[model samples]
Target: MDLQSDLPPLCVTCGVCCTDAFFRYSCVTPEESARIHSLGFPVEREDGREIFSHPCTRLCGASCTVYEQRPATCREFRCTTLSALEEGAIDRPEADRRVSLLRAAVQAVRQLLPKEEKIWALRARLYADPAAAPQTRLALLSMDILADRYFKLKGRRFFS
Candidate 1:
């Protein structure tokens, strides 16, 4: 049986998790770190944890170039919508709709911020600056709310 083929096409079409749209970095084990580094991707230490930063270098336009050799963190990570879909808590169409909403939200935030700035960092900068535009604040809040509702697991820190 081709189990992989039987799986839904959700993840292949939605690579937000592979980018800074969700996380700034993914936690990696020592072995996975070494493997990822060997694959020509850099692994670094952050706050005493081994991690690979995102938007992942291996990601090429929403597809992972090193997917077959991706780290444990990458292989194991699942967004809330994916989990809901796999658990039959929601149907594929709903899951896809959620993904689409989150993507649009991310795009809106991107339009308001610099191309290279991670959402988390920019969020902080914006929050700290009282002079920040209300539209930018609204975009960030909308993105984050959608992210929390559709993607992120409860208490799952993006820095993780």
Candidate 2:
């Protein structure tokens, strides 16, 4: 998803990200590619080297063929907040505040990026720095807390 800070509100029940086999999915590492190829899936050449398509044939409609054995990247990607925001489940003012905090945090981080990372990724470093202001730290914590429940991988989505 390019992992942009301002990515669109989560796909909701739109199921769009799952459809067309996630056209942008590309979790190809040499080892993983070799594993998929061993399963008899087509592995085509791109730029004279083989490229593995993500969201493979096993992705049946909105369902996964192997949810339990899905690759590491897919398992780790948690689009919780986006999904909640899109489903109209997040408390509006809180979501707005969290988003504002995120935007401000990203702006601050960009000045120091390539060294710093996503505000979500750099939460610890920023929060731990004594130099960070109290209000800023509080805002970061709010963002973190909001981020926590926005996506629940273990339960059904809370859509309204």
Candidate 3:
């Protein structure tokens, strides 16, 4: 049997975790770090640990290009929606709805700041400027609210 076929489809469509929605970087062991580097991913050393920022180079739009060879963090990480799905607390349709909502909100944020490379940087830029255009400010506020809602649904706190 194909066990993966029985799994929830949320992660297959949601790239938020890989795109730096919840974390700026993911840590990896030295060995995994070397492997990731060999795969051409940009890795950095922080406080004696190897880390990589998002959107991960290996992530190809909600899917990992190097899934089988992905680092332990990527292999093990699961969002709350995924957990809920696994436990039968939620069904696939509901999970798909939530993922869709998140994706829409993220798209809105991206549209507002098209040139920003990452979520953290976009948030920083928005927060740093109080005199931004009204539309920009409104977009930032909307993004903040959406991010909070997304994290809350994921059973976690919004970092920013």
lDDT of each: 0.81, 0.46, 0.71
Candidate 3, poorest ten consecutive residues by summed lDDT? 151-160
Per residue, candidate 1 scores C-alpha lDDT tens digits across 68-105 of 88888878888999999889898877887998898889
Clashes of 1: 0
Candidate 3 segments whose C-alpha is farther than 4 A from its true place: 1-9, 114-116, 144-146, 150-160
What is the TM-score (0 to 1) of candidate 1? 0.86
lDDT over C-alpha atoms for residue 59 of model 2: 58
Q: Across residues 1-160, which tens digit of lDDT does each residue of candidate 3 receive? A: 7554676456667877787655788888876766788888898888888888877878888877787788898778766667777788877777777788777777766776656566677666667887765786676577557556543444555432
Show where candidate 1 strays beyond 4 Å. 1-8
**Cα-lDDT of candidate 2:** 0.46
| lDDT score for residue 137 of model 3 | 66
Pick by TM-score: 1 or 2, better one: 1
Compose the digit string of candidate 2's lDDT tens values, residues 1-160. 4343444332321222232212333344565776767655566766655544543555564355555555555445556555555566764455555545444443444445345243333445665687865655666555444434443344533110
Ranking by lDDT: 1, 3, 2
Candidate 2 colliding pairs: 10-82, 80-150, 80-151
Better model by TM-score: candidate 1 vs candidate 3? 1
